[model samples]
Target: MELNPWAVAGLVLVALVTYYLGHHSSRSATSTHDFLVARRTVRSRRNAAAISGEYLSAASFLGVAGIVLKDGADATWYPIGFTAGYLALMLFVAAPLRRSGAYTLPDFVEMRLGSLGLRRFATAFAVFIGILYMVPQLQGAGLTLGEIVPGAPAWAGAVVVTVLVGANVMFGGMRAITLVQAFQYWLKLFAIAVPTFVLCMVFFAGGGPAGMRSLGAPAPPVFPKDTTVSVKTNVTVKVNTETYFYAYGEIDDGPARGAAHWSPAVPHKVASGTTLKFAAGTPVPVVSDIPATNDTWLHPASGKITDLLQTYSLIFALFLGTMGLPHVLVRFYTNPDGRSARRTTVHVLLLLGLFYLFPTMLGALARMYVPQLLVTGDTDAAVLMLPSALLPGLPGQLLGAIVAAGAFAAFLSSSSGLLMSVAGVVFTDLLPGRIRDFRVATVLVALCPLALTFLVRTEDLSLSIGITFALAASTFSPLLLLGIWWRKLSWPGAMAGMIAGGGSVLAALIYDTVCGYTGTVPPWWTVQPALISVPAAFLVTYVVSRLTRSGRPELVNDIMLRLHAPDPLGLVQDRVVARFGQVDDKARTGRGRHRKA
Candidate 1:
């Protein structure tokens, strides 16, 4: 395990700075409003940065590169769809939701439809979605740190992030989080950009290879040096050429001396903890995916029914899912008015779009430079590992450290937002306890996902995060879009749609998660449920609202006016302030002077 002490130190240092900044900013938060929405005083640009910071999770920082590296150009749309989700938010959700002046999604639901039942249902989904989103952050952390230090337990990184994020949230609340998150966003951008710049420079300085851009199928990836590759899990490898295997730490495991098998009907298992040594000229065996040659590394799709369905399903989930995310919506509430909300979203789109460009570059370069990862299924670590592979020595390690810091920043910033959203829902809507309840909620929210990390494998993590998006899109996207635009949506319709849309997707996700563990593969439809589930949620919601006579005309009229009216009109109910003073009422006080004193 070649763990760089500097890289580990860099990760811890960012966590400390984040905690201190959050704590310092939180000192002035004396009320629940301050804690939850920063008193609705966030400016456009800062809030946009914070939103982007949280939105670019480990998936954006690390997973995108790995997916592109493994799957080629067809996987490029993940980042595009991710950035475009903001467009959906700006058009349908941002201004009106901000104008409504609610602190959380459930608050908006209750305010819009006048139903406590629906509020609880929405709150439940918020908690579920927050945790569902958070588990991957933990998984990525473990995978990242594990990649840095090969034998490190996956839980180590998760534990470190949770501790830092929990402290940040427990101390600062939203006011603190806004500053901390915005800072992390720039830090992450620097971390990714600087390394990308340096690596590209190095690639060109080494004299850009003519064969690096080969389009037709070429030879399999060759080891740049005599290397020993470690297998982290039990996987089957397709050996197209002869290779050497060292079994049980000895050079005598094959039939001649090491076991070598031809293409057999039954695939052989390379058990966990096995190590394979290859000479410099050896061809790396392909695993689990179609053979990719140098000539066609940039192919559009894998020509699989599942890949096409998964791509469209992913695009739908990410595009529609952004507006419905609980944490993302809370950032809009922190904006002072509707115009600010729209402006913030526009900035977010620009920032995210700019940051996404380099990951594709990293992925493509990684394919030529570090194809061994494709064999190990640790392509997610390609972003972190690529720098060291290209630069070598201290220069490479330093660049690698920068990437690690950005990766940790991704976990910290995103985890803090998720914790805040979950705790806010727990305190205000679900538990309804005092400020102390936030402390309790923070621990519970962090613990659930940390425990879940043990159950989920690091392989195909983008798919896992996509499944959660499917849940958010299916269940809440319909409710949010309809409640804002459609006047006649009743509380009953909202509840029914949430149940049908969210329920079906949730069931499919559970089946996939569980079945995946038992070596069972669920159908493509079950894995990517957005196309069917999202439409079903919308359909059920519209039909139920039409049949149910639950909405009152006056309440609907009031909510609609507030949502659509300009901020100068002051129609939004956000101005209600709580104040207390000596009443000095003689009848009630009996002694006015004593009451005042």
Candidate 2:
């Protein structure tokens, strides 16, 4: 793809203005409220927009489309889980988390758990989750930039985005991020929606059903060749002895790649009627199991159990993890009161719905128009590839530019939010004894992830996301839910759950990394950790609370009343004067001395 100077120029202009707004907004902010929660003054609509913008990362824009393009209807789980997750947030997590009035999840932990040790553990967990989440955003930015600037390096793109994000977070904190993410959400929707509409027209005019068949005709029964494609699939433990795996990858040049192998049979108990085939003279390899359709679009493993695992894993992560997201949680504090927070969650759902519709459409378009991407082995690039391939001349260039800008925004918005959350935790909870330089705290947090991005790079945005989700589900989700709803929740149980749950997940992650276990890595590695760890946390808090019962039920009632009540926090008082009670006024006139009798 060729670079258009004008398009590049447009992107640069957006970047500059975004940075200016973020930097300028912070110059006046001096207090903790200004730095952490935008002084809790944002309205519902803006807060909602900012929340949606922050949550919709490169995965929503690019990874989901890419997954759908490569895997068909099964991939729809991405959007469904994402939207449904917010519903979960609105119902179970939103108001309670906001009402806690803690700056970060760790702060909430410290307050609820009442132990410096527990706070430190939660802080570390947060930093880990935040960094794990940051990597993919940086990678997504690099991928988008590489598409636009022909010769630009991935790290260069990463650097540009990191700097922009850091500057915004450093200067304005939550206030600046609110504006950026809110603006970015609309921009992202436009970038995807306009191109998607144009592509749909092209699809209909180009041949619709007929053109699809014609373009698809040359596609081999299994185009290219077939080999034992090494696909990373999720498996579960029904028992210890028997492990399950599914997913077949591309085989470039072999009998399996070219010839048929039915005798050996498909492993993992493929669907009863599933058929596998290979076409001749096809230049690339294709692997699919959708017997009737024979379209490469639906090649993923098929089974009731496997399907359930994937669905549940996605749902759990999406729903539970949203509450734990530092970025999302902090937004609640941006509102003036609980009502604004509740309203913000509602508006966020609407904005998220609007934006989600576009990416799903684009993913479908990519499957039809840009099947060639499967050959390049980068499905994640589908969002970028489809635009340039279909549109010629200026429209293509313009859309490409828009996408590039939007991608940068996604990275910047998400990164800034995560960095801000981490910074709050580090400064307040991690170093509670002393006040650190505010500037130093912000930079320290930002720099760590920026460094981590360079050290670990991946094309798999989904995998990166899963790592973060697993971490969040294990630690903060358990901590927050128990802390809020369960009055019996003891600080000991909170500490135990966070450590046990968080530690188990961390150990699994390490094993996955060191052992190179390249399966979907199993939902057990994900959901099991949360399911068990969360309970353990609750139990520990219970037992520990029983042992050291303060019996201060009134404290619990008081906190609840404050959180749920409709007062303006009642932390300030107004001065009043009455003219009728003014004997001092007569004394001031000097005739008052005579009136003292």
List candidate 2 stretches off by more than 4 Å.
Answer: 207-301, 430-436, 515-554, 567-597
Model 1 lDDT-worst window of ten: 588-597
lDDT against the true structure, each candidate: 0.80, 0.63
Q: Write down the TM-score for model 2.
A: 0.79
Q: Candidate 1: which stretches are off by over 4 Å?
A: 207-217, 239-267, 294-297, 302-306, 551-554, 575-597
TM-scores, all models, native as reference: 0.91, 0.79
Residues 282-336 of candidate 1: C-alpha lDDT, one tens digit per residue: 5666565634455445666667887788778878899999888999999999887
Which has the greatest lDDT?
A: 1
